[model samples]
Target: MWWYTFAHVVYHLIRWFPKNNRLKIRIVIVLFSFGLLFPQLFVLSREHSTRYCGQHLFDFLIVSIVFTFFMIGFSFIFSLMDPVPWEVKLAFHIFGVIAFVMGLTLTVFASLAVDCRNNTLELYYLSVSAAVLTVTSFAFLMVMIPFWLLNYFFPNSVLNRKERTGVCYEPTACCSCLWHI
Candidate 1:
């Protein structure tokens, strides 16, 4: 879980270069990682199942919502950086929104499964839920790890640094031209 969180932070920092679109991508990555960590939290709530499965569900929902908001907030902050094509940004947002919603739904169901009594029926449900969440989480991680590695080893190829002021443009196009006038 800590490794997942650390990877998210590193991904965000890397996205700060070149275009801001990377930030939105990173946000999705973070949310996906959060989805992966969510099932483990149910283990914590398992100790309190006698209180009612609804209680565990509520806790899961609240945490998922809070984390979703954080992910979106970070994406908003990234938007304030270098301008990026709206389509690219929109693509990221759409994927993120869907992923977040699915994650929350799966987590709630998983929590409910865990909160249920340990019997053959409940075990079957828990196993199925666990299998689905694990498979989905692993698929996301598989994609994310390769993407991160590609960017890390060849930063220049995958990332673009901000252009230095007065460097790329011709001298005649500089503010110095107006000063002379």
Candidate 2:
């Protein structure tokens, strides 16, 4: 169901682009690059000297999500501009970085600082959750991109043989079965 929602949103988001495939591809590449950055940060955080720092994988995931949100927001803002002014783009870029840092700090404080630290299992749980969710999101994007491009280039090309004659499944159906849960 959440996958359905994600696909629905992404479908609309792809369509929301200005019909220039080059620009669309560029935006998708940028977003995917940002997506790839999280795991490197996760690796770095794991090597931190402080135990508490690496102990909270869920907190790190939260920070990553917050940063991704800010990135997407900034991308949307940039997409709205026709001929983007250098100063305006620079200003938004600085604001996005500041906002992401603020969000990361708040999430860390909320998830780690306020919680009681006696149990070791919670640490394990956070780490496991972060790993699982990170992998899931990464795989989801991997699956989504091909389907998105298929839908973009050759829309509604797949047929649903079990259904009525000539009925077709949308390209999103490619990964919908795997992620429907």
The positional error of residue 15 in candidate 1, measured at the CA in angstroms, is: 10
Per-residue CA lDDT of candidate 2, range 37-137, in tens? 55535544553313554445445545555555555554554544546588865765475446445444544443553332443344444444444443454
Write model 1 residue lDDT over 1-181, tens digit each, in one string.
Answer: 2222333344355444566346566566557656644654554345443345532443544454455455545445443444446775575556555555556565556655653444333333543554365456656666566645666676533333244333223443544332110
Q: lDDT of each prediction vs. the true structure?
A: 0.47, 0.46
Q: Estimate each model's TM-score.
A: 0.34, 0.31
Clashes (candidate 2): 0
The TM-score that candidate 1 achieves is 0.34
lDDT value, candidate 2, whole model: 0.46
